[model samples]
Target: MLKNPFLDVEFVPDLMWFIGQFDVYDREETKGAELAVYNPDDECDREKLIVKYGLDLKCLSYRHKFVLVRFLGEKLDDPNFDFQSLFEIGEDCAGSWPRGEWYNLQNPKGFLQDVYVNAKKVWKKDLEKAALEDPSTW
Candidate 1:
């Protein structure tokens, strides 16, 4: 039997996890709970596809990474993720795990659009491979 090219709805979390782990932070410097997570912090699930295949995850996390694979070949065929400004916080990881935030965008979802504009060139091969591989394989 042939398999579907789109991502299975159930795989959303894994795809998100493949990108990185997310956490909400309540910072006085920013209103509401600020979203944060370290990029490519695969400590939780490093044995997944990208790692097994030896492709670099790079600094491009969920935001930019999602574009090439289309949320694992399912979402953003039109490209509106419905996120905010999207800032890259935490200049220093301080040598800790899982780095920092996830979404936390106040600028506009379009900011990610700008990043996606060049995503294929940046993560073309790696994204394609990970998207095609079974997350449960590991």
Candidate 2:
């Protein structure tokens, strides 16, 4: 049912090594952590579809964030819903970069566990380090 044949494959590790950099911060934090934006367009071959829906290597490490973005951009083949769009969605769900509180995500409860919750789980250590280090003067 998909137009692009490549967007139907499974995502692998090589397609998700970008999240090793970002650290998730909670509310009330003065400073936030920096994330390495991985633009696969620069590193990998475009013609070859790594995942069925196109994976954003940048959000790979943050499982919840990555899944949420993928959910936001279901139409991976649509030119309007490509990686950049996913980045936008990620920013939307995860709040703006440099530690802004524009769209803070709520922790998931009930059956559907929120992606941000899981993402924080993966980046907790890094986020802790960033929080304790202080960001205003830096």
Candidate 3:
């Protein structure tokens, strides 16, 4: 009984392409540097999603980042999906800088993998719905 219907789709190249533009950096190093370094000028439908979600690049584990891309791809397939809500959710999920000492001390990969798994479980219904609707074109 998934509520959102985009999770079941296959890999989305467009979303992946957009996600590839952002390179994760050390939280401290990103302070003064140009944010544009991570984002290119290439325009696409996924740009807005990138802008919101990409801001959390540093906080996300490398693998967890892909989840966002896949999620976006699913949303793209749904004509009725609300772009505004997606953007808002992205903003809410953006991680904060100067991560706690405990967070910095933990294994980032392991931590993020856990996060990703939990997220998938929470959004499973939505993903299943999406997959059922479009069956993933790609």
Best candidate according to lDDT: 3
lDDT of 3 by residue, 1-138 (tens): 211223554433333233333333344466314333332222331243234443333533333334463665565557775432211223445443322322232332332233344445554655465545543332
All candidates in order of lDDT, best leading: 3, 1, 2
Clashes of each: 13, 4, 6
- Candidate 1: residue 93 lDDT (0-100): 36
Best by TM-score: 1
CA deviation > 4 Å runs, candidate 3: 1-103, 135-138
Evaluate model 3: give its TM-score.
Answer: 0.29
Better of 2 and 3 by lDDT: 3
At residue 18, what lDDT does model 2 achieve? 26
lDDT of 2 at 54: 32
